[model samples]
Target: MKLVTYRHNGKTSIGKVEADRIIDLPRNDPALPDTMLALLQGGQDTMARARAVRGDYSVPLSEVQLLAPLPNPSKFLAIGMNYRKHVEEAARVGVQTPPTQVWFNKQVSCINGPFGDVHLPAVSDKLDYEVELCAVIGQRCRRVSREDAASVVAGYMVCNDVSVRDWQLATQTMTVGKSFDTCGPTGPWIVTPDELGDPHALRLRMWVNGELRQDDETGSMIHDIYAQIEHLSTAFTLEPGDLLATGTPSGVGVAMSPATYLRAGDVMRAEIDGIGAIENRVVAEPV
Candidate 1:
């Protein structure tokens, strides 16, 4: 089932998306948690309950505004240069490949709705797009082995690790550039593991306007999701709702020979096979 956070008829709630409608969980059972994080922390039993939801409390998906599925995650993390071609492209831009997983914080404050507009920061003209596969942690645990990593992940979502390149490169910590308001766009809905199957085998893509830009398979990741989970958990506990952006592939605007960054009015779309897509138009940040 696709888990979603949606707003309809002036109320927001965690919902189950099916066909062309969204099943309102809170309306069906007030016992259900009201937020995605609460639902996830409720663990398997809560998930089972959400799946068994059956009622007249559903609305056409078109009538609801979809928000970031896990809008208030404890943390939103991303792995950098985890794709070989992406690593190669980074090297071209003078960013070196790491000997170990290069992890960064996208700051939870940056979180944006699946279809929300992305801001072109007034401070920089180097805005860029990176379409990535995001894993949402379901449990609070540390030092997880790669073998057990799959069990801890709640589900997956498509994420756009929008970057303000100049600010990102101005410092070793990319958080500033990556965490600009509206920089992190994720959702549509969360596809639970059972529904998504093998995440690494899916094809992902990015487009500007209607032209294809970044296209690659999750299989191209140099460090798979399990490895990322194992590595990240080794450093700290990964709590329910924490997001792990697996990394983008090679065709980012920065890697193009002439460096074609996003401008105001540009539209960006990111999607993964089996999962759905999210499209956001770029608008300039207001003073």
Candidate 2:
């Protein structure tokens, strides 16, 4: 079942994706709840209800807006250099790959809708784009075992971890470079865990101005998603609606021989197999 959180007519609601259009779940259903977070918090019972819901709502998908699947995540964790090609490219740029996962916080304030626009911040001319597969946690987990990590997943979504290279390099930690407002763009649709078999085998790709930049399969990931989850859960409790932006593959603009970067008016699209694509345009930040 593909689940989605959408807004129409100034009201936001949870719905199921069918035939590329979201079918509104009845608010009075005994099993399903109203909000995506509530449905996730309800666990399997809510999912079961979401699966069974049928028929239509008042709004057609064309009239509605798709928000971040989980707008306010308990934790917005991102993995860095988890892809082998990305590692090699970083090395080519004189960046070192850490022995362990380079996890960083992408503040929830940076979250934007699937079709939203991302700003080419005036503060930094080194803006870049990262196409990634993000996992949405469905259950509360602590010290989670790698063997059982898949069970805690709610779904997957396409994400663009937009970065400002200058701010990111200024700090030892990458949060400042990563957490600019509107930096994290995700959605189009969330493919439920049941339908998106083997998260590590899917293909993720990204394009800038209609040119393919990053094109690689998740099978190329060095540490892999399960290991990333197991490693992260060991340090902190993973809760429902928590998001994990599993690192991007190689072919980023900054890694180019001439080091290209995003400019205002450039449109970026990131896509993952089974999970739909998300697109955003680069625009100048308001003065």
Candidate 3:
């Protein structure tokens, strides 16, 4: 089942997506709560209750505003150059692929919903887009084993990890380049892990203004999702609402022969199989 957080009547509420319409989850359900994260924190039982929800409180597809699947996560970690092709592309630019997983943090303020506009920040001119498979944690755990890591995942969503190449390269760390407000665009809806088994086998693709840029399968990932979780959990607790970007494939603008970068008025669309797509326009901010 596809789950979503939406705004209607100027208020945000949790809903389930069914047949292109949103089946609004009733606030007064005896079992499940109203908020998306709360429902997730309630674990599998709440999911069962949400699945049993059946009603036509659903609104038309075009009627309401869809918000980020998890509005504010406790932590947002990203794996860098985990795709083989992306690593190869990075090698061309002198950024070597790591033997272990390369991880970084994205400020929560960077998060934005699907169909939002991403600002080309005045501080940098080399904005780039990365299409990646991202997952949200369902349960809290520290030092989780690889075998138990996948079970802790609540759901998956498509994320565009917008980067400022210049800012990223100067510091040798991606946090600054990756944390611009509105840089991260995620969600049309979140697909529960049960519905999207084998996260590593999905196809991830990205387009810049209708031109296909990155097109590779998650099977190409150097360090797959479970490994990433185990690796990260060893260092920090994976809390409920924690988000992880599983990394991107090759075909980014910076790796192109001519080296293209996004400018004001450009658009980007990213999609992953099972999880839907997210599209965002580029607009200039005042310098």
After superposition on all C-alphas, the RMSD of every candidate to the true structure, in Å, is: 0.8, 1.3, 1.4
Off by over 4 Å in 2: 26-31, 56-58
Model 3 lDDT per residue over 1-287, tens place: 88898998897888888787888886535466778778888877888889988864678768899988887887888999888888898899888868788888999999999888999998888999999999889888899888988889988999999998898887866798889989889898889888888888899999998999999999998888888889988988888888899999999989988889999999899999988899999999756
In what order do the candidates fall by TM-score, top score first? 1, 2, 3
lDDT string for model 2 (124-239, tens) is 88999999999999999999888998999999999899999889888988898999999999897778887998898898899998999999999998888889989998888999
TM-score for all models, in order of appearance: 0.99, 0.96, 0.96
Full-model lDDT, candidate 1: 0.94
Candidate 1: deviation at residue 205, Å? 0.2
Each model's lDDT: 0.94, 0.88, 0.87
Identify the candidate with maximal lDDT: 1
